[model samples]
Target chain A: MANFLVWVVWLGAAFACLVSALAVVSFRNPFYSALALIGNLASLAVLFLLLSGEFVAAGQVLVYGGAVMVMFLFVIAYLGDKSEESPWSGGPSWQIVGAVLAGGAILAEVIVVVGLKAGDFLSSPKPVTRDFGSPAALGRLFLTDHLLAFEVTSIVLLVAAVGGVVLGAHARQGEDPTEVHART
Target chain B: MRGPDIQWYVILSAILFSVGALGVMLRRSPLIILLSVEIMLNAANLLLIAFSRLHGREDGQIFAISVMAVAASEVVVGLGMIVAMGRRHVDLDVDKLRTLRG
Candidate 1:
């Protein structure tokens, strides 16, 4: 019974993900694309929950859906939301042909790679532990096995923060601050 | 409800990644390209978590967390660049930003 519910929820989440992802690539207005991607991210979080990745799901929601989406929205709103339809939408035939060929090639490669020996991974020999993807388990790995990488990630985040502020300041230095808002 | 086959997740991840790659290649807006990259990153992270569950190990999930952190930083830096670009009144068509077109 529980498995049935998981299946149903997974189906709904996957459908939502597919629709929103398609919308992300197809929408002419970038604001719409940003909104669609947020929906996609939220659906992915649900899938993570289905996989028992509680910590990962929370992180996805907090980081991607909350922080990242907010930044995208901020940029869109500040930049003045205009419908800038992609040039690729009505370009010469060769452009579409090339893009389609390239995209198709990538899709074929991914399908081939993922399809190989895929069944073997699903049939696990033992049951996963209740705490397998719990915060405690992930934290243990973070501190012990993956300690170096874990700490390095923190350093990277710090550097990125400083870099962002510096970049923003540099941009602010040349332009009249009032003009930025006025244009919007 | 008998738990999904691991292959199903792999297929979904592959599809998402492919779509994201297409988005990045075809989109003109820098912001949209960044969004595409985020989609690609999430696809990879989902695959990692799925494989972790399949293999009964915490390694993949830990790596996913690391990926999340990297993603957060990436968006910060990318958006900073976008904000900078906006200040210059550079038309958001990224193809025009080429200074070394040799």
Candidate 2:
């Protein structure tokens, strides 16, 4: 029964992930695409939980679903309706065909590789310690084994924050911000 | 109880990545392109966590966390550029923004 329950949840989350991913790409409106991305991220968090990644799963929800997505929503809203894209208006027909063909080719190639070469090794789950994915374990690894990466990530975030503010200020100074808002 | 096979997760991630790639290729909107990039990143994150499970290690999760931070920063800067373009009344179409074309 326990095994059956795990399979059920896995199937559901996988299906949700696929559906929301499609919705994210196919939605004509950027706002709807953003909303679909939130769903995709949430379903992915569920998948992370099933993979025994407790800390990663929680971070997925808190960071991607909450903070990052909210920022996307704000930008979409701020941009107003001008952000909407007419379906395949600017690009030529050949570009669309090429894109679909390339996407299908990538999907087929990955499936073949995973199916043939790595199938056996990846078919079973490895045994894990009781505290395998606990926040404490992750924190220890972050501070010790991956200390430089962790610190570097913080510096990158700071630089990005400063860059965003500088660009925003420059944009505002280029024109009357009120004029843009009024036009929108 | 055993869970579903790791291959299943990997295949799912691949599909998600392909869909994201298609989105980036087919869409003209910068916002949608950014959103598709997020999808691609999340797809990669899914694979990382799955492999982390397969190897019984925490290293992949650490990498996934780093990817998340980088993704957030990318989005912030990209959106700022988009806003700047909007203020200039530049058309949001990516194909027309080719001022650097030789």
Candidate 3:
């Protein structure tokens, strides 16, 4: 039964991911692309949870799929209206060919790198069933061992937040108000 | 791992990552490109946690968490910048982005 659940989770996550990817590519509308990205992120979060990585999964859903995606959609709604030109007119033919070739090369390289070694990067950590969100575990690991890295991440987020404000504000200042702004 | 023996999870991740990369290459909208980048990062994160589980390691989970945190910061700033640029140009198309292009 447990095994069945795991497989089910895996299947569902993969399907969601595939759909989201297609949506990302298929949609010409930037808003729809943003929405698809949200779906993709949510599915990936579910994949994380299925693998028993609960904290990361929760963060994936909350921080990324939730907050960041909404931020992106806001941008889309703001900018996409004025240009009525489809962003999906597609790229130059040569560029598409180049992209395909480059993607293939990267895929081949990754296949070489990640090759035949499921055993290398994994070991059975205490399963989520045994303990979920034990603040003590997070605290101990975070404070003593991972504190420096954690501090760096805080700095990064601070930068991102401040940068967002400064940059977003600058754009508002730059818009040529005489022409059409994003139509509602 | 033999090509066939590679767990479905690993294969799926690689596929997703490639799709994300392709999307980045093909999409004209900055927002779409950003989404593609996020897809690539999530693929990496998925692989990280999967490895942690297969090996019974907490370190992998911890690392994954750190990556997630950093990813959040990236989105906040990165999207802000993209949107800023979008607003200014009123054009997020990749072609117009050649301002920096040599």
Candidate 3 error regions (>4 Å): A82-90, A112-115, A118-129, A132-135, A171-184, B1-6
- True contacts preserved, each candidate? 0.64, 0.81, 0.53
- TM-score each candidate: 0.89, 0.93, 0.82
Candidate that scores best on TM-score: 2
lDDT-based ranking: 2, 1, 3
Q: Candidate 1, residue A153: CA error in Å?
A: 0.4
* Residue range with the least summed lDDT across 10 consecutive positions in model 1 chain A: A82-91
Please provide, for model 1 over B1-102, each residue's C-alpha lDDT reduced to its tens digit, 9 standing for 90 to 100: 156777778788888888888888777788888888888998999899888887778899998988989998999999888887786676777765554355
Clashing pairs in 2: none
Over the stretch A56-95, how does candidate 2's per-residue lDDT look in tens digits? Answer: 8999999989999999899889889889887656688899
For candidate 2, the per-residue lDDT at A7 reads 90
**DockQ class, candidate 1:** medium
Docking class of 3: acceptable
Task: Give the number of the best model, judged by lDDT.
Answer: 2
Binned by DockQ into CAPRI classes (incorrect, acceptable, medium, high), candidate 2 is medium
lDDT tens readout by residue for model 3, B1-102: 111122566777888888888888877766677778888888887788777666655566777777877777777777777766655554666677554533
Better of 1 and 2 by TM-score: 2
Per residue, candidate 3 scores C-alpha lDDT tens digits across A57-170 of 777788887777777777667775742336446569898888878888877777766665445342223344344333456557778788887788788778878887787675
lDDT of candidate 2 at residue A76, scale 0 to 100? 87
